[model samples]
Target: MLDFHMVYTCGYWSGSPECGLDDAQQQKLNLVCRNLNLKPGQTVLDILSFAKFAAENAGAKVVGITISKEQAALVRDLCKGLNAEIRFEDYRDTLGEFDHIVSLGMFEHVGPKNYRIYMERISGLLTNGGLFLLHIIGAT
Candidate 1:
């Protein structure tokens, strides 16, 4: 259903539900990058490969981690020539400090048991005074 940028999660419509899927997905990406205050040459860690918007729109260097090899390959191809790199690996195995971090639709997978550890890892990877945004869809 999400052929537009394969967002996979709900859009950041911001009350613009009249917009089409592609527009909504693009808005979601832009919203995340803007909230993170990403800037040119700055390092950004995206839990999913939503780097296109941050890299192209905000000119930030984005490093994304995904467990699926196929998804990584596709995102890598899509982000070619941009300051975006997609890695096929577990998030816990990731290293390096980033000026900002954005995690979308992945917190739920972290599970309650690993919540503390997950947050700690993300904290360690972020530089002091860095920004972190965690977006999730709640279904009770």
Candidate 2:
């Protein structure tokens, strides 16, 4: 139920209805990178792999993790020759620290039972003053 690109996430229209799906997606990616203030040679952990490509394009060393084997393989293939690493692993098992962490549309799976654990894991993964951006749909 989406465009051919299969990008299932929020889009930044910038008040232009003429914007194509890919254009909107690119806009969102740029916005994320800008807000994170990513720098060259910095480390980034992209949980869910949504912003891996964008972060890589911004010259950051990106480590993207996905539980789905298919997705992991897809990202690896798509990001070939770029400073990006795609891993098929659960976030609970992730290692090392990151200058920035970005997770989109994946927190719904964390559930209330594992919310504390999830937050703790994220906290442990981040470096001092590291930025984390989480985008998820929820009811208030």
Clash counts per candidate, in order, are 0, 0
lDDT of 1 by residue, 2-88 (tens): 746766777756576578777777888878877877779999998984777678788989998999889899889889999998999
Tens digit of per-residue lDDT, candidate 2, span 1-140: 13333345776788897998778877877788889898888889988645455545688888988899998887787778888888999999999999999987788889989999998999999999999988777987
* TM-scores of the candidates in the order shown: 0.91, 0.90
- CA RMSD of each candidate after superposition: 1.6, 1.9
90 Cα displacement, candidate 2 (Å): 0.2
- The number of the candidate with the highest lDDT is 1
Any idea how many clashes model 2 has? 0
- Single out the weakest 10-residue window by summed lDDT for candidate 2: 1-10
lDDT of each: 0.84, 0.80
Error of 1 at 109 (Å): 1.4
The residue pairs found clashing in candidate 1 are none
